[model samples]
Target: MNSGDLPPSRPLLVVDDDRKLCGLIRDYLAPRGWQVDMRHTGPEGLEAASTGDYEAVLLDVMMPGMDGFEVLRELRKTSTIPVLMLTAMGEEADRIVGLELGADDYLPKTFSSRELLARLRAVTRRSVRSGEAADAGKEWSAGDLTLNEETHLVTLDGGNLELTALEFAILASLLKAKGRVKSREALLEEVSDRRFDVFDRSIDVHVSQLRRKLGDDPKQPRFIHTIRGVGYKLKEPA
Candidate 1:
């Protein structure tokens, strides 16, 4: 497809040292409505990401010179773009490290092509939609939290809280539907475009991390409250 015909809104970057693997992933994911870009090193990936054009980054964990973790740290220093790390099988520690370093998700090596496509779509959808100006300047308030949809920023108790892309989306979704309980399935759909699976615990993990970042106690959440078997709700601060 020509540049004009490309889905600019769905552009994604795949960063891996493996030239063959990168080519394979880029080829496999291109026809699925994503404009895929490939990078062969962490520095190159970081430079591309710094441009702030790509919707999301699919980063590989192992690379020479600058590893994925180091790259992740550097990217987090300046950007909040959604990042999904590609780890090797049984590398649970690497996966956990990537998550704690602020990656939005993880996909171990030997992952299914279909699953990768699903995740790429889900992540790109979330990123492309987050900064979208929907109902501009509409105010959404929950508890001590307030969001200006136009500005796309949040304040907790009158203080600015640094939030990543997924964190902001999760909170925005919860605030947009304050009061009613939103099941995990619904929340997953809200964050991504896909339906929920019993094995998919990533949303829960994200919610938990968001709550922690927001300094809300799960036992008595001041902003987001869990609904046990159902999902969660954004508690309007009194």
Candidate 2:
């Protein structure tokens, strides 16, 4: 069929061993203009993700060889393509690990199709928005840390820090509000354009990753601080 006869397709890669679930997702997303490709093995998924022209990847945490975390680690070595992780329900550790490893977001395996669609849209949208903002040439600095929005480059102590897209977004959000506390809810909405869930700890995970990259000690933070019972803030250099 011609492009006009159907909605514009957004290509997505789904890396999952559950053939049944993959089929269900394909059936549900095909009509909605998502061209979903499924890979049943982690190595296969990693290969496809590296070579494919996909807007995002839907990765399952459980797989035989290499697993999703390994696949993600390998993939991030080369690509900044958005990734959404699928973890078992209530598996907080899995979710946190996935986020720390640079997955854009995570959903429980028991998620509804509607939630799946929403999460996918959120990750992709965040990716696009970040790209646009990065092209704007805006720059922000706090302490010895500097972030260049246009180039998506961050430097600490005159050295470059390799940050994932989500990490950049979270750090940029904090730098923009330097000296002002930004609640996790505010950061989540600002970075992902999604409603905040009080129970969700993905934002915290990302923040911790950012802290490590910034060489900020959580107990004696120099760049970012955790305001107990509140959220986080970029410390204004004294």
Candidate 3:
């Protein structure tokens, strides 16, 4: 498959201990214009994910040696590579745990091929959009948080901050609409290319992660503020 025809900048990486599933994914995505590389064990997956130029990673929660959580936790320390975790069906806790560990999205183990494709496209498209030059030279700032669209660089208190694509997009949305309460629906629409229900808590999870990285306390807030049941807003420090 010619990778240039795909939305992702590079090949997709699928990491699962289940060889049959990995093969199935490769078979499904390849004909659809995505090149896929599979790594079976957690350690191997972590190494490939850390070293490869893949557009995104399809990870399984249950794995050998390190497990997906351990791998994702390690990966997020240095790289913001998009990760779509595969979890058992109806495992809400697994989904939340994966999200908290910085997984961009989660798919059930029994997902349809079409949903899989849509999800893969959605996550990869975010990376492509985030890396675009459309916002070149523009900048947004609130308190110590500064984001340079041209450089795709974010800084807090003069220190560089590495943010996942989703986190960066969410932060940018909030920064763009400074002092206004951005409801989850409005925020999700602005940041995601895929359709997400207004009640999806993934947006809230990303915001929490972003807030932690920004060193803002949810209580006695410094930058991002929860506007009661409305949504969130970034207050310019006084």
lDDT (Cα, tens digit) per residue for candidate 3, span 1-238? 4463454335889999999999999887887777899999999999999999988999999997789999999999889989999999988888889999999989999999988887887787778777886578899998778998778889999999988988988888889989999987787767765566754687788889888999888997888999887889988987
Comparing 1 and 2 on lDDT, the stronger one: 2
Candidate 1 error regions (>4 Å): 1-11, 29-36, 90-96
Q: lDDT: which candidate is best?
A: 2
- The TM-score, computed over Cα atoms with residue i paired to residue i, of candidate 3 is 0.93
Off by over 4 Å in 3: 1-9, 194-199
Backbone clash total, candidate 2: 0
TM-score for each predicted model, relative to the true structure: 0.82, 0.91, 0.93
lDDT of 1 by residue, 80-150 (tens): 88899999998877877887788887899999988887776667666656677777778888767787767
Please list the residue runs of candidate 2 whose C-alpha ends up more than 4 Å from where it truly belongs after superposition.
Answer: 1-7
Global lDDT of each candidate: 0.81, 0.88, 0.86
Cα shift from native, residue 26, model 1 (Å): 2.9
Give the C-alpha miss distance for residue 180 in model 3, angstroms.
1.0
